[model samples]
Target: MGTLGVLGLELVQMDTPPTTAYLQIYTEERCKANCLFCAQAKDSRAGLTHIARGMYIPADLDAVVSRLKMAYEKGYLRRACIQTALYDKWWEDTVYLIKSIREKSDIPVSLSVFPLGDERYEELCRLGVNEIVIPLDACTPGLFDKIKGKSAGGPYAWERHLDGIKRAARFFESVGTHLIIGLGETDEDAVKIIDELHGYNVNTALFSYTYVPGAQLVLETNKEESIRHYRTVQMARYLILEGIVAYLDMRFTDGALCDFGAQRDVILRLIEDGTAFQTSGCPECNRPMANETFSMMYNFPRKLNDKEIASVKKELGLG
Candidate 1:
């Protein structure tokens, strides 16, 4: 629905509009896979239009595609990101949407989906999808099994997801994945997976596990703990990706990151820049409030003010 407003398809107001046009395929059928955290999961009782606080209402495809062309040309949006749900004809709808956008404009396109075959990956590349994201969602295999794999009655397997990312990397220049924090993952666990995915040339985007009323999964957690874990992984990920430190160089105690191994001045410099805190994903994609509330923001959609930066430092125990 936010994308609708940005495209002028819906009357809405947003303090920080999304830079990428987030389009989800419309279908009454729920996903075949039963991922517990997903509102669109087969067994989930949550509304189908809900995806972590973002309401994606059904809209006319041609209308959205046409407006998307105008929005891109005017620079209100940078990329067209197509999110998919696992249902019959998903591939067909996804292909049609991508082709529709490509025929109208030269805008950069991104596709976020589950694992696919080599032919499909190549097809996505041909369709002008510059970036492909296959979300792992969990920090480790055990957590994955519990949340979205066989244990949760979902079709996804951790090894296959990792394998899918590797396969997709061959077809697309930019391959990325997602990891949801506060799903009972330790700081060290999050950073370690980021390091591993880095070896595969994959960029890992971070999300805080959000609780929706009708979704099956539930956990008791505090805000302070959640932010602390996110901040640590974010900083550690930056240091590792920047080549300032490696996961092996970092110190961990009881599965928590005890030290980042980078010097105080280097860490301070990164914090001041604030790129480490923004939404980490496809280029030019800043998901404003995608996984946050007004009082707490996991990913600052834009540059950080001095006060927010100070809050970040405090979250990392540096303030």
Candidate 2:
């Protein structure tokens, strides 16, 4: 069972659930990367089921596919996403899994995997991949190395990931990338990357760094600070993506965002709309509670009501 299944979107049990109809599947193999922030790192003791803040039970692919097919037919499933962990022959396994899912259903597929070259991407496009996610987990090259690259003895490279995202933008219509906040990066660092990726026409999925026990990188948690920073970045990404604001229009002081270069009323109106605070990812993909708890939501899975909007305003220092 996948995380959604465990969260009560059970394919075999639930006839109708009010969750996003996207099915997420992760490769069972252990990842080779030793990223300090990741629970799935090669040296981490965290179990596979606890890697992504959700539990996944190992099950037969055929059975999983049967359930997915049922969900798709019943209008409970809209798309499917396959996430790969780095391992020997992982790419081969990912391709095979994509083929398997395609053979079984006509639902659009999105793949999150290690950076690959042009030929491999072309092959995936031919395989009917609807979109591709190449995650630049850390914003800057220095932070990338320290968090997910050579400083951590990880296989992923900063330049390689960027190049892959650029290539994917050319090949795939909907290219997406992931960014995790509170990874020892300043607000300037985060927004700069968001601006650069926006230039590449790639969608950015912003995530807050959720503390996991026994992780290599031990960091203090500041709820107020984290919420402020995340809300600011989320709003910035949404504004830039929607063409409502540009990176040049954003101003920072001492590496922190101080001004959006837009009128205060205009900014408030945009904030009140509340779409900026929702989960960021592929279209129609909402993994509720994937990063934080319900009361202190890092990414709202649905639109925010008036009360929720007030809560968000308080968090953003607007109320």
Per-residue accuracy of model 2 over 82-108 as CA lDDT, tens digit each: 777788877777788788878888877
Task: State TM-scores per candidate.
Answer: 0.99, 0.92
- Looking at model 1, which ten-residue stretch has the lowest summed lDDT? 237-246
Error of 1 at 114 (Å): 0.6
| C-alpha lDDT values of all predictions | 0.91, 0.79
Q: What are the RMSD figures for all models against the true structure?
A: 0.8, 2.6
Q: Give model 1's TM-score versus the native structure.
A: 0.99
Pairs of colliding residues, candidate 2: none
CA lDDT of 131 in candidate 2? 90
Number of residue pairs clashing in candidate 1, backbone atoms closer than 3 angstroms, sequence gap of 3 or more or interchain: 0
lDDT of 1 by residue, 148-259 (tens): 9999999999999999999998999999998988899888889999999999889999888998879999888898988998999999988877778989999999998888
Off by over 4 Å in 2: 1-29
